[model samples]
Target: MKIKSYFQFTNEQRRGVLSLLLLIVIIQLSYFYWSSSKSTSPSNSNKSWLAMQSVIDSLKISQSSSEGKIYPFNPNFITDYKGYQLGMSLTEINKLFEFRKQNKYVNSALEFQQVTGVSDSLLLAISPYFKFPDWVNQPKKAFSSFDKNTYENKKSIIRKDINEATQDDLIKIYGIGPALSERILKQKDVLGGFVTMEQMESIWGLSPEVIENLNKYFQVTTIPTVNKIDINNLSVKELAKFPYFNYTIAKEIVTYRSMNNGIHSIEDLTKIKGMPNEKIKIIALYLEF
Candidate 1:
């Protein structure tokens, strides 16, 4: 009986010991799992930091390449370097805005130069940065042909017939001002059309040089026949038929011719009190004695 009891007590103690061992093994496994989970959490954090660092490095590289591409040929960048040397004051530089408005680049820098006398080297420095618009170099070719045609037509009219020519035709010729055109029309009304090129010089205020310049562009082919009248017998109305001889001048001419017993020669015209040698010379080409 004693032996059985001792064996029973030993069996019970062994079972208790096995239970404590099992508890200790479970505690160790839990500790290992917790420690491995803590270690893996730190490793995940480290990997995340590495990934973030890679992303930041990629962004830095991209920024560097972008800056490299835009460094050259930037107009603003070029202007910044050149504007300092241009010597343009704030007010003068402001004038560029006005010039930009009208698109007039030819006179853009002229006013600035007048004010500051900016050096030529400085002007050259800024010249490249200031882009003259493409249209300035490529002016409208639309008027080119029209201008050429007008120039040719003007030359043709000056050398052509004058009696049949209209006012439009007369204006095309050189040396014909508005006053001269009126004078020509008045002379045509009094003595018909021009019979000789020399008659143009007889117009009021016309100089000899003007007549000489115009002679190259004109010619005379026809002369109108004037009825031979005895100057002494001529009435004021008949004497007024002469070109530039107004009613007052006609009365004077008729009175003088009557007093002088009818003018017969070109020298007789000079004998009249009001008729000067210069005046007779101008009218001689149109008159028939």
Candidate 2:
């Protein structure tokens, strides 16, 4: 009986120890699941804190580069963007200026690439602010009746010869700005005179628009003959040949004709603002309109 009781006590003790071990394992598993669930909950603030840190890092980089200004980024960062390149060259930059003058704002870097098959680095440098003005994208405004007729009247009076165009003849070309007109005159002197319309392109400041506009007015004819006795077309050298006409009077007459177009009739001679009537009549007999 004593041996059987001892064996039963040993069996009970083993069962009790096994039950306690199972309970401890169950509690450990439950605690682990609860901790995992808390970590994965959407209400966890750590994720937001990590995102904020990333944004702060990006802002720090931007501020350091820009000296704290928030202006748009410079185009030099094209290298950082995948598949983009600093593909333009110095020669391409010169071509962009030429293209811009001809097309105004119609051309962009993409269009330039299409036209020249090369990119422009200077244009890329300025591309961040590149934009066409509203007027360029919109249809052109029509000229008023007075403006149209005034241009027509002026066109009828102006005469041009590509071989012998004076500064005044160049000014008459539409779209030839004052600066460009002066450039043409300077080029004419430098080249010893223009032999062809293409020569105008050699001028450093001559825009393509000026060349196009002036081309319409160009004539490649023999130089016109000027009679020494005709005051209308006579140069200072020819006028000085007259016995009584001094260099001053010759220059004055040429200046007057330039301002008012050539004196239309002998009676118009007296209309020169400063010429005395007696002197006009003397010159009138020798002058032809």
Candidate 3:
């Protein structure tokens, strides 16, 4: 019997194997052509990415512009930081500070301009939102809700010591209500007591009209004794806390005191390097020597 060899292939099987090999070679050639056509050249992709980045940058700019919108605020209370943010020049800011250092308030837009000397364009930009105290622009209707006891309690109205008066007592006066009464009491605490009714003019929201009412109804009969700071004894830090004394002036006062043995009078303080000459008279009210 003739044995079949295990390694030998029949004609049909050999043809099938050859056909399969031909198909694989044809597939590989097509794949090469397809890959060549679709290779990654990223010019268009890069352009799209750059265009997206530009849009994102524009959005950031727009967001920043929106954030710059100014709101209504009191111009009198602008601090150094606020002035800088509002684009005020150093000279203009200094002018405002000098005005405020005298304990005067900016009552109107025209007054603010005169005090700060801001440019006309800048003033137009910011002045629209410059809100002063309520009673300044629109004086409130007089307190019509006065109880019969308000007049009946005769002695209380004659001379209610401003420092001793409670909020209830303060509201009895016309043009004074809850808010104004609290402000008066709070300022009284900070100042120890009102020396002059003029001091009430410095309160944050009190208008001239309201101050007049307060003066009409109440008197600072008992000037609360304060521990007056002796300029010769106070350090620069202590002296600078007073409204009239700034850091530079206070430091100069201390230095001048040390140099000349001690400051003898207000004139000596005014002679200090940075001290305002006119400020000495009012500053003397808070200082002993």
Each candidate's TM vs. the true structure?
Answer: 0.36, 0.28, 0.52
Q: In candidate 2, what are the lDDT values of residues 76-109, reduced to their tens digit?
A: 1222221123345555545555655564433344
Question: For residues 22-47, what per-residue lDDT tens digits would candidate 3 score against the true structure?
Answer: 99999999999988866755568887
Better of 1 and 3 by lDDT: 3
- Native-to-model Cα distance after best TM-score fit, residue 237 in candidate 2, in Å: 36
Alpha-carbon runs more than 4 Å astray in model 1: 1-158, 174-182, 204-213, 226-230, 237-241, 246-252, 279-289
Q: Per-residue lDDT for 157 in model 3? A: 54
Could you report the Cα RMSD, in angstroms, for every candidate shown? 29.1, 23.5, 10.5
What's the CA error at residue 18 for candidate 1, in Å? 99
Error of 3 at 182 (Å): 4.3
Q: Least lDDT summed over 10 consecutive residues: which range in candidate 2?
A: 74-83
Query: lDDT of all predictions, in order shown?
Result: 0.59, 0.59, 0.78
- Worst lDDT run of 10 residues, candidate 3, spans 276-285
lDDT of 1 at 64: 87
Clash count list over all predictions: 0, 0, 0
- Residue 104: error of model 1 in Å? 39
TM-score preference between candidates 2 and 3, better one: 3
